[model samples]
Target: MRLMGLDYGDKTIGVAISDELGWTAQGVETIRRTNRKADMKRLGELIREHQVEEIVVGLPKNMNGTIGPRGELSMEFAEQLQNTFKLPVHLWDERLTSIAAERTLLEADVSRKKRKQVIDKMAAMLILQGYMDSKKRR
Candidate 1:
């Protein structure tokens, strides 16, 4: 079984896939959002290609652990994914994931343009990694 992770945003959806053992998550690609049908079609293709059995979506919650508008959007996306794919979709807290991704990129001296191109994918990787790490802790 394989797991997929998504960092859903207004402009793009960052995609990540776990290894066969579910130990590591690797950034796949960033999907630029056009419309729901197109977006889902692309996602379906990835799911099929990866043989993904489960999905984890990043939910951007407030520092207080309260779901905000962004988190609500992620929740709706996750629900839609569950209904459309008939696969279990989990929401993982994504507070500061993007910030962390940016910090890492900056520390590596990534050009601003390059960082812009890959930040979402990096964030998705972090989100998935965090979720997998939490599972390992249990």
Candidate 2:
């Protein structure tokens, strides 16, 4: 079954999807959040198109392993996703995925403008890949 990943922010939500075998994740697109209804509608379309069976949302916890405001926001968003999609929504710790994505892009010599546009989607892919890897290890 396929899985979807999301990196939710105040202004945008990065989206990624796993391969049918769930072995790899690919960045889909970044959704610019204008309102909840629109966001949910777009996500519903992606969910149906990808045949997503589950969702993984990035939870931004503090470095000290404490849940901060951002973490709470992510949890709330996860709840909304679960309620809307009627599918399991897992929260994956996203401590440094963005930083890692930035580093990866820099190493690849991506231009700053392009990096700015794609960093969130890259982070979503990283988060999804991490969750898929953990499931494989189990």
Candidate 3:
């Protein structure tokens, strides 16, 4: 089964997808969030087009492992996803994933402005990649 990964942010939703074998992840398009309804509409199209089976959303938590405002918002997004698509939605811990993505982009010589534009999508890729790797080890 295929899975779509998301990094939910205030203004954008980073997107990634698992490989057909569900063993790898690749960066996909990022969805610019307008409103809940608009975001869901765009996600529905992606789900249909990609033949997605499940969704994996990044769950942001505070450094001390507590849910903050962002984490609560992510949960809300996951609920909407489940309600609309009727598919299982997994919330994967994503603390520091964006930081890791930022460091990676820096190492790759990506410009600051460009990194800002794509960091969310890259973070989603990291989250999806981590999930895929763990599944492989299982």
- Give Cα-based local distance difference scores for all models: 0.96, 0.96, 0.92
Query: Which residue pairs collide in model 3, if any?
Result: none
Q: Model 3: per-residue lDDT, tens digit, 15-105?
A: 9988788988888888998998899999999889889999999999999999999999999989989999999999999998999999999
Candidate 2's displacement at residue 90, Å, is 0.3
Worst 10 residues of 3 by lDDT: 129-138
Q: What residue runs in model 3 are displaced by over 4 Å at the alpha carbon?
A: none
Q: Estimate, for each residue in 4-37, the C-alpha lDDT of model 2 and write its tens digit.
A: 9999999999999999999999999999999999
Best by lDDT: 2
Q: Per-candidate RMSD vs. true structure?
A: 0.6, 0.6, 0.9
Work out the TM-score per prediction: 0.98, 0.98, 0.96
- Tens-place lDDT per residue, model 1, 38-70, is 999999999999999999999999999999898
Against the true structure, candidate 2 reaches a TM-score of 0.98
RMSD of 1: 0.6
- Per-residue error at 39 for model 1, in Å? 0.7
